[model samples]
Target: MQETRDAFVFRGGAMAAKPEIGSHDIEIRDCDVKYYTKRGFRFRDGCYDIQVINCTADAGGKEWYVEAFPMSFNVIGGAKGTNVYDHDITFIDCIASNNWHINGDSYWNGDGFCAEGTAYNLTYIRCESYGNTDGGWDDKSANPLLIGCIAKDNKKNYRFWSGAPGALLWNCVSAEPNKRGGNSDYVGLWTKGKIRIHNSSFVDSSKPLALNDWRVTPEQIANMNISVNNSLIELPEGKELPAPNYTVSNTVIRPLNETGLSANGVGYKKDMREAQILLTEVRPHQPRIEKEGRLLETKPLNVFSEKNPSGWYLSDWNNAKMKIAKGKGINDSNALEVSTNGSKGGGATYRTKRDSATIKFANFQKSDWALKMSIRTGSTNLSGLELRALTMAEAPKTKEVPLPGTLNGSITGWQEISIPLAKLKASASEANFANFAGFYIRANGSMAGPLYIDNVRLEPMN
Candidate 1:
C-alpha cells in the first residue's frame, strides 16, 4: 500500500541503466518526465503490478532514427526478444506527446510505449497521445485493453502485430486532422489479433480498418451470431465502406467523397453526394428485463408470451378530454377508468381518470436500467403513450421523461423506441420510488385515432 514518486529529469542520451527493481505494487502518480537519452522508464526484470496515473511524458524528438541517438529515444522499454512479461498494469489519465519519426521506418525510438514478450492484462484508460511519429501505442504482447483513450495527429494510433488474446479497444477515438509530410496513411486503429470494438468513433483518418485475419477464417462467417449496433464510423471523402462481418444498426456511416453501390440490381450515390436518411429497425432477439419477486429479473422480457401481458400497449383519446373508449384495452378491470369531453372538434377526446392495469414486479433496486417500447400510430391524431410507476396503495403518478415526440408515419405499422433508464429517472425525478412497485402505460387526450404499442421490457445492467 505504499506510494512512490520518481520525477527524474534525465538528460538526452546521458542516463545510465539502473539496477533491477524487485517486484512490488507500485503507483507512479502525477510525475512529469521528459527528454530521456534512452528509454524513459524501464520496467526492470521483476517489476509487476505497476499503475501509472495522471503522468505526462513528452519525448522530445521530431523524427525517430537510430542514428539520431542523442535526440531520439523511446518512452518505455523492456528487453527485446526476452521472455519477460508485464502483467496487471494500468495507465490512466496519462499523456504521451511529441514522439515522432520518419515515414516508413521500423525503428523503436518514436513509439509512445513498446511492450515486448508476454505482456498481459495491460490497460490504458482515458489517456491521450498526440504528435507521436511512429504510433500512439505499440503492444507486442497479450491482453491489452484501451478504454476511453484518444490518439490524434499521430502516424499510427495503434499498431499491434504480436500474437495476443483479449486485445480490445472500447470507446476510443482516433483522429488525424493533419494530412501533410506523412503519406496520410493515418490508420486510426490497426490490430492483428482477436479484437472487439464497441461504442467507438473513428473520424477523418486516411484508413480506419480492423484486421481480424489473424484468427478468423472465411469459413467461420457462416456459423457466427454477430450484431453491430450504436456505432458511428466516418471516413474522408470516397472511403465509405460496409462494416466487416456484421449488420449495421442505429449507426451513422458517411464517407467524405462521392461513391456508389453496385449490388442487388440497385445503385445509389455514396458519401456526401447521397442524401442522409434516418432508418431505424429493431431485432427481436435482444433481451428485455422484468420484475421478479423482490428483485429485477435478469432475464429478457418475453413480449410475445401470453402470460407476460406486460407487452407494449397503447390507446388514444379524442378531443381534449381524458376518457376510456371501447377501443382501449384494460388489463385491470377495476383500476382503469376514462372519460371524454366533446371539446372543439367533433371527435370525442378521452383521458385517464385513474390508474391503468399494473405490470406486477417483485421488488425494485437502485440500478442503471433501460426500457424499450415500440409505438405506432393507430388512427393518426397525434397521440402519445405515457408510462408511470406507482406504489401499491396510492394513485399512480406519471414517470415523464423526454420520450420521443409524436412519431410520423403511416397508421398501419409499429415503430421501435428505446429509452435509457437514466434519462427516465432524470426527467421523472419527483415520481420515482425506491421500492419495487409496478408500471403502467396510458394514452394522452383520447382522440378518435388508435395507438398501437408492443415490445415493452426493462433491462438492468450490473
Candidate 2:
C-alpha cells in the first residue's frame, strides 16, 4: 500500500502502531513529518517490509530521547525504536537534519538520526544529512549499508559501535561544518565495526577516518584484510601518522642490537674483521721497515698499473723512477709525465695512453672474491681504469673493462670502491682466468693530469 503523509506533525507518546498489517509491503513517499516531541517514527510493536523514499523528518525543537526519562532524559531527536521490535528498513534519497534535544534549562542532547535496538538489512542510499547538535547518523545495530551518502557540517558524521558487521561505506564524503565553534569532534567516519571503504574520499573533515581504538588488539589487525587500492587519502600537512606493522614476502628484519646473520648462515662480523685487515695489509708484497726503524705503510695496489711499467712493482718507486710532482705526506704523492703533445698536468691527464697492460701475479684462479680499490681523480676531467684477464699467449691483447666513475669531490681524500665477485663475473662474461693469468689496468680519455689510486685488494668471501 502506498501512503503519502504530508505535513504530519507528531509530539510525544510513541506513534501508535498499525494493527495486523500481515505480509504487506508499505511505502512512505514524498512525506514531510515535523515537530516530533519524541521520535518522528517509532516502529516498535511490529513493522516489516517498509521502505521510506524521498521522505524527510524535522524535529521542531522537540526533546529527543533514546529510551525513557530518569535513566536517559534529554531532547534526543530523530527516529527512535523501529516501527516494530524488529524490521527490515530501507531509506532511499531521504534527509534527516537539524534536530535538537533539551535537558532542564539548557539544550543538551541532540542528533540528526539515531537507530538502536534490533535491525536487519537496513540500507541507506544517496541519503544526505547535516547540521545537528550530535552526530549526523548514528547506528548501533547490525548489517547496515550506507552507500553514496553525504553527511557534512554535522558535529559528528557517523559514530557506530562494535558488534556491528556488514557495514559497507562507499562513495561517502563527510566535511566540517561551515561555521565557527562547531566543535569538530573525533572523526569523519568513526566505527568499531568491520567496515569496507571503497572508492570513498574522506577529506577536510575534523578527523578523517579512524578504526578500532583501545578495544581492538594487534592480533585483530593482523587477521583483518584491508585492501586499499587507487584511493587518495590526503592528510593535513605535518600530520603524524601512527605506527603500523606490516608483513611482506621474502623479507626479514632484525632488531637494532641483534646479530644480522642467520644461525645457519655466515655472519657479517667475520667479513668486517677481514675487511679491516685488507685495508691495512698490501697483498702479495710484505711491508719493508725503513732504516729509521719505522715500518713504512705500502701504497694501495693498482689493478691498472700498466701505465707505470717501470714503477709498477718497484720497491722504492716513491723515491725513484716516476718524478713526484705534488708530494703530500710521507706516503701520498702525485706522479706525472708530460705527453708528447704538451698535455702535461698533475692529474690523470698526463698519464700514459696505453689502452691496456698486463700485470703478472704469482698465483691466480677462478674464485668468488671481492675487489676493493680507491681512485682519486684530482682533476675534473674524466679518467678511469680497466681490469682484464690475460691469456697464456705471447703479447696477449688486454680487453678493457671500464670501472665506475670517479668520485665527485676533492681528490685529496680517499673513497672506497667495492665490486662484488658476481658483478665482476657479469661484467667479464667471455674471459675465464681459471688458474693463473695476468690482469691489466689502463688509463684512457682526458689524460691531461695524473690519477691517484690506492688500496686495491681482492679477498675471497667467507
Candidate 3:
C-alpha cells in the first residue's frame, strides 16, 4: 500500500465523507500491506464488527524518519465524553513487523498493534507481532482478549491499560525483547487495569512484569485483582521481579536461560532489533497515604489548611522551588511560597492521592461550590495566573480559568480568590468534578518573583 500519508483509512461516524455511515461489518482477508509512510491499516472510532484475517503489515514508516506515528495496524477510538467507539473487532493469523519511526528524542513510535481509547471487545487469535520500534501490543480498550498470540523482539511486548472488566491474555507468549546498548529489555507486560493471564509465557525480558497507576482510581485499583495462573515468567540474570501488589498464583519465575521458535517459523530471538519506544528506567515505588475507609468530603475539603505542605507540590520543578513555612501567609499562617526561574511551565499543584475520592457536585441543586484560596504575589503581573481543574481520564478533560482582575506589580498583602464552580461548569460543561484529579495554579512564565498561597480549600459560597 502506498499513500501520501496514513494509508488505508477506515473511519466511522462523521469522519467518513458523503453518507457518513460508519465503517462497520467489514472484512479484510489475505491482504499484504507494506512500506507505508504512516499507518498501514487505520481504523478509527465508530468502526465495529470488523475482521482482518490472514493479513500482513510491515515497514509502516521508514527507519530513522523524524515523525511520531502509531502502529502499523491502529485501532483508535473517539474523543472522551463522546460515546462513539470502535468495537467487536477480530484479527486472525495477522502479522505486523518492522514498523518504526525516529523523533530524535529517546522515545518515538511504530507500534505493531495499538488499540486505544474506549474501544471494546477486541479479539486477537494466533497473531504475531515482532520487530516493532514501540509496543507490540499497546492496548487501552475497555475489554480485549488475546489467545495464542506471540510478540517477539519488540521494545515493549504488551501494555494493557484497559477500563472496567479489564483485559485477558490466554495461552499468549512474549519473548526475546529487543535490548539496545546492553540495557535491560523493557518490561514484558506493563499493566494498569484488571488483567488475568493464563497459560502465558514471558521470557528474556529485563523486567518480567510491571504495574502502573497513572490516572487509575482507587476503586479500580482495588478491583484490579491481577491474577496470573499457570504462566512462565522469566527475567534476565541479576534482575528480580518486584514484590507485586496483586496475586500471582501458579506462575513460575526464573532467570532467562533459552530461546525458541514461534509458530510462524521465525526464531523468537532471531529478529532482535531496536526501535523507538518510551524508554523509562524502572521507577521506584511511590507509597500512598492509606486512607483506610476515610471517604472524601468535598463540601468542606481542606486541601491545604494544614500547617505543612503535605500534599501540595510544585510543577515544572526543574526550574522551580517550593517552600512551606509559617509566618509567610495571610495573617501569618502557614503558606506555600513558590519561586520559579521564569520557566515556561512553572506552577503549584495539589494532586489528589489514592485515598481521595472523586469530587462530585452534580447532586447539589445550587451551583455555588467554589475553590477558595488566599494569594499574594510578588510578581509583575497576575495576568498569566490560572486555575486548572484536572480530571482522572487518560486524556484528562481540564478546565483552565484565568485569575480575574490583573494586578500591575504585587498585591499589598493578601487577596481572597473565590472561583465559582458554576463558572467552571459553564466553561467545561461536561466537567462536574466527578473525576476531579486535582487543581493547578499555573504561572505560565508570567511571574516575576515568588507567589505565596495559603488556605486553599473547596466549599460552598458563603
Candidate 4:
C-alpha cells in the first residue's frame, strides 16, 4: 500500500449520489486512505464478506470509523437515537491514527473505530487507534467483538455508550488518557447488555469503570451478564486518585507483574495466550459465575430534622470553617459548605452529634443498600472527604473493612458519591448495623480547599 493523502474519493452526501457496488465480496486490502469529508470509505447498502485488511487511515473527519461504521457504513450518517445496524464486517491488522479533522458546525472529529445505531456482529482483530479526539473505540451497538487492540493519548479511550447487547473486549490496552477528560480512559456507561472483558489491561486511568449510579442498575448489569475477569489496571502515575471503581460482577483483578506480562512477552502467561480456551476448562472448586441478585429501589435520604430524635445532627468539625446555604441542596436548594484549615492527626471529623444509641434498618440485605451523598468542590483541590459510619455502642466503634473510594474528586459541578453499604462495615460486629447510632462525615485534610455537600440520604443500591 503506497502512502496517499485524501485518497477517499467515495462520498455519501444525503445518500443521493452513493456509488452502487456488487453483491459479491468487497475487499479493500493493504491501502492507505487520507482526507475525506464524511468518511474515508463506506459501504452503505451492505454486502457479503466485507473485509478491510492492513489499511491505514489519516486526516478523515466527522464520525470517521476509520475501520467500520456499521448500520450506516456508507456515510457520516444515522439518525441520532435510532437503533440501526450493518453486519458481517471484519477488520484485520489495521491502524486508524490521526484520522481527525473538523469540517463544519454539525461535523465532529476523530475516532479510531465507531459503531452506532444498533450495529451488530462486527469484528476487529489486532487493531489500534492513536491521537484521536474522541476515544479509541466509541460504541453504541450490539454483538461487536474486539481482540488484541491498543489505544493511546486520546480524550477518552474505550467509551461504551448505550448499546443493544453483547460487547466483548479481549487483550486490549488503553493508556495515557488525556488530562482534560472528565471520565477515565476505559469509560463504561451502557449496562443493559452482556459485556465481557478478559485478559486485558487498563493502564493509567484513575476511574476506569465509572457507570453513573442514576443511569445504570446492578440488576440491569448483572442480568446482562456484564463481567470483567482477570484484568489488570494501574492508576495514573504519581497522582493521588481515590481508587478504581468496581461495580461489576465476576471481576478478578491481578497486577501486571503478577501475571508475568513483561514487555518482551517473555513469561508467556497462560491467562493471555490461552484465555479463551481455559474459560471452558474449570476445576471442581471453581464457581460458575452467573447473574447477581434482584435489584433494589432508591429514594430521597430524608434525615436531620429540627427535633432530632434519631441523633441526627450536623457535625461540629473542629478547626474548620462551615456554612449552610439554604435552598442550595441537590433536590432542594440548601447545601453545606466546609473548609479545613487546622486539622491534625487523622484530620478533622465532621460527624453528627448523637443522643440515641441505635436506629433501625430495613429488611433488605446490607449489600442491597448504600449511603449516597451529592457533593461538589468549588476548586479542583478539595479532597479527602470520608463519610463516617458508626456502630451504636457505649462508644460507637468503627469497623476496619476497606471503604469505597474517598471523596477525592475535583469535579466543578455536583456529582454523587455512593458508598455501598457493604463497605460501611468497619468490623465484623458491624456487619449488619442494625444497632447503629447513625452516619456522619469526616471532613479533614482538605487537599484543594473548601467543598460543598448536600442531599445526604440513605437509598437502595440502584
Candidate 5:
C-alpha cells in the first residue's frame, strides 16, 4: 500500500481469524481506500472495541461473498461456535460512495456500509454513505445505532433488519432517493423488526420508509415496531408517508408540488442540495456526541407495567375464575393472579395494541431471545401450564410450549423462570408465527389454587 496525497491505496481491508486469535481494540483513521478487488474494509472474527474514523471508501468490489456482500466499510460476523459477533465497533465521520459489484446479483449484493452475519453493538456517527449499488447503510447488527448520519442516492438509503433489542437511529438524514448511478434507487429507510428513529429528516424521497422484508405480507409487517418521533419528512408530489402504519409523533410532513416547494416557500430540494454541498466538504457537520450512555446497548422488552398490567386481562373458562390483582406482585406491584374453584382450565392474555392493522411485537427471525417471568404459586396441583405466542392470521394460530415442571406442587415464593425462544413448539402443518398478536397463558387439566405471574419479559440471550 502507498500513501499518496494523504490517501492509503489498498486492494482491500479486513480482519479475520479464529475467535481466540482475533484482533481487538484497533483503530484505522484518515485513510482513503479505493479501486479494490473484493471488499473495501471488513471487520470479522469477533473483533470488538474497534474504530474507523475520517476514512473514505470508493470504487471497490469486483467479487464478493453473497452471504456478506462487499461494502466500503463492512463488518461480517457469523456463528463460529456460539454466535460469534463483532461487538463495540464504531465508524466516525466516514464516507462510503461509488462502490459496486454489478454483475454479481440483481439486488441482494453490494452496499456502502454493511454489517451482516449478526454483528452486535455497532455505532456509526456522522457518517455519510451514498451512491452504492444496494444500500447505503445496510446494517443487520443486533443493536446497530446511527447518529447524525446522512445517506443519499443509494438503492435503499438505510436498510436495517436487526432483531430483539433492535436498532436505534437519531438525528439522521436520508435524501435524494432514486439517484444512484449503477442501480435504481428504491426507498429511503427500509427497516424490519424493532426500530426507533428520533429527530431525523427524510427529504425528497419517493418512498421514504418501507419494509426491508421480502415477504411484504401485511401480517408479517404488522409485527414490526417502527417508532419515528419528531422528524421531518418531505416527499414529492403524490407521495404521502415517511412510514405507513408506524408510530410517528410530532412529525412535520411537507409534500413538494409543481413549484418544488412547500406551502410556506420551504424549498426542501434546495435544502438537500445545500446539505450535499456541506457534506462534500472535509469534516462535515455533525451533532455533538453527548454522553448518551452506550448508544448501541439494548434493553429487555418488559411485558408488564405497574398500572393496568400492560393490557393483560383474565379469560376464564370451565368454571375457573381469574383476575389481575394489584399490589400483590413481586415487590408489591401489579400481578396476574388466576385462581380456580373446582374449574378445568383458564388463563390470562396480553393483547397487543394495533397500529392500523399491524400488530407491533417481536419477530423471532434474527437473534436468540428468551422468555422470562416470575411465577409465585399458591396452589398445590398446577399442571399442564402452557405459554403461547398468538399469531396474526385470518384464522390465527398459536405456537405453544409447556412451562417448566418446577412450578408444579409445593412451590413457594417467587421463582425466576427463563425459557429459550426455541422451545416454542409447533407442528409442521401449523402456520408459522409470523407476527405475534399477543401472548397467552393457558392451563389445561384441573387447578387447585391461585397462580401468580409477574415481571414477564423477553430478553436477548447472553
Candidate 6:
C-alpha cells in the first residue's frame, strides 16, 4: 500500500476522501492488508460510499485492521456544523484476523474492525474475525447491520450500536472464549438497541449475550423490541438461560448450517455454510459469484418462517393445476406445485397474507432488490409465466414500470431467477411496501405441465 500510494500520490496525499469535504465511491476486492504500521486502510473525514469485498486485513502491527472515521474529529478547523458522516459504507465477504497491536502508542484501540466514536449506515455481510485484543467488529457507529457474518476466538465477537434503537442480525454464527478458550471470559455479541435476530447459531463463548436477555431482571431488560426467531444455541452445561419472549422458537446443540467450529483457535476462512435462510448471504466457499461483487444493499424478500404465515389462500388451477402439497422443497419440507397437460395453458395465484398474520417486507419500496427463487419445473411448455409484486389487482405498479417479468417456460427442473426490484410496478405509495399486497406467481398462460417452487426470497440490490 505504501509503495503503491507513493508511486501514485496525487495533490491530496494518500488519503482518498476528506469525507466532510466530499464523497467518493471506493471499491477494493480480493486484496490483503498486513503488517501495517499505523492503520492498514484508513477512511476518514466525511460522507463516503466505500465498498470493500472479499478483502482481508491480517497481522497489522498497529491500531486496526480496517478503520473508518466519521467526518467529525479533532482537526485544525473541525467538523462541528458539518452534519455529514461516513454514509453508505459496506464490507462484503471480508475478514480481519490477528489485527491487534501488542505494544504501541495506540495499543488501546487494537480492534479487528472498528469505528471509533459514531458512524452510520454500515453493513457487514459474510465477514469473519479472530484473535483481536478488543473485538471482532467494534461498531461505535449508528445503524450498523450484520448479516450472515461470523466471529470466533475473539475477546468480543461483536460490539454494535445504532443512533436509532435497533440491531438487525440475521443468520450469523459465533463461537467465542476471547481467543483464549476460557469460559465467561468473553462476550459473543454486545449490543445497545432492539434486535431482530433469526436463523443464527451461538456457541459456547463464555458469556453468550451481554445484552438484556432472559437472564436479566425486568429492570435490566433494555427498553427495546427483541425478536429472536428460529435460531440455535449451545451453552456450557448448567448455564442454560431462559428463553426470551421474542424467540419465535429455537433449539440447542444442533448443527444449524455451521461448521469449522471447534475449540482449536483458527482464523475466519471462507464460508462453507450453503444456505439462504436470511436476506443477504455471505459465504466463504462460493464459486458462482466472486469474493467481491456488488456492494449494493441486499435483503431477503420472502421469509417463509417455521410455520406458514396466515391469510394466504391457494387458487384451484384455472389453466394450471396448483395445490398445497407436502414434502418437496429445496430446504424446507413443504412446497407449492403446478402440474397439467400442455395443450391448454393456465396458472395459479400466489399472494401475500392479508390476515392478521401477514408478514411484510422492510425497506421494500425504499431500495431496489433482486427477486430470487428455486423451482423444479416438469417437462412442459408453458407459453407465459409472470412473477409480480404489487397491490393493485388489475393494474401493475405503474405503466412505466411493470408488475411482473415474463418467465422462460421452456426450461425444466430446479432453477433460480433474479429480477431487478426497480422494475417492479405499484399503483400506490411505495413507502412501507409492507402496506402493499404480497408477491404473486401467475404461470401457464400456455404450458404443458408441472412447476414446483420453494425458498422464494428477495435480496436488496442497493
The candidate that wins on TM-score is 3
Q: What CA RMSD would you report for each candidate?
A: 27.1, 35.7, 13.5, 22.6, 18.8, 23.3
Error of 2 at 352 (Å): 99
Better of 3 and 5 by lDDT: 3
**Model 4 residue-pair collision total:** 16
For model 6, state the Cα shift of residue 303 in Å: 53
Computed on alpha carbons, the lDDT of every model, listed in order, comes to 0.47, 0.43, 0.64, 0.49, 0.63, 0.51
- The digit string of per-residue lDDT tens for model 4 on 1-462 reads 223323443211111111122132667788776654334455332232467777776644434434322111222222221111244466767777654544333323356677663344566667777766565676664566767777676655665654334567766766665533223233422234555665566655554544434556666544444456656554344532122333333333433223333233221122333323432342111222221212122343444322233334444445555557665566567677666666441322333443221333422333355666667765465544555665544432554332233344544677867776667665545445543455554554544566666666666664
Q: What is the TM-score of each candidate against the true structure?
A: 0.43, 0.40, 0.53, 0.43, 0.50, 0.45
Report the C-alpha lDDT of model 6 over 14-85, residue by residue, as the tens digit: 111122333457776777766543444555444356677787766543343334211101111102222334
Model 2 residue runs over 4 Å out of place are 1-24, 60-85, 102-108, 162-164, 177-186, 212-232, 240-462
Q: Report RMSD for candidate 1.
A: 27.1
What lDDT tens digits, residue by residue, belong to model 3 across residues 1-462? Answer: 543356577867522111124578799998888776667788775677788888888864455243556467888764342345677778878998877766454665678889876577777777889987678898887678776688887877888886446677766788777733222246677777767776678876666677776676776556555667667777566765443555676666666665542222221222212111100110011111111111223356555763533333444454555667677876677787766675575666666543123343432334456777787865556567777765554333556788754455656567888887656653554545544456766667746767777887778774
Query: In model 3, how many backbone clashes occur?
Result: 0
| lDDT, candidate 2, 1-462, per-residue tens | 112222332122121132233222667788766655444444432344567678776654334332211100112211232122234556667787655543444333455556564444556666777665566777665556665677776656776653424355544556663321233344566666555554455555436556555656877654433222223333455542243421122212222223222222211111212322432332112121111111212222344322334223311111112233355311554433211123222212112222112222212222455556555555445344454433443332334456565633345455566665345443454343322133334443334444454544555543
Off by over 4 Å in 6: 2-21, 60-81, 101-108, 163-165, 179-185, 212-221, 224-226, 242-248, 251-462
**lDDT comparison, 2 vs 5, better candidate:** 5
| Distance from true location, Cα of 334 in model 3, Å | 36
lDDT: worst 10-residue window of model 6: 69-78
Tens-digit lDDT track for model 5 on 11-50?
A: 1111222233345767888877776544667666456777
Q: Comparing candidate 1 with candidate 3, which one achieves the higher lDDT?
A: 3
Candidate order by lDDT, decreasing, is: 3, 5, 6, 4, 1, 2
lDDT of 5: 0.63
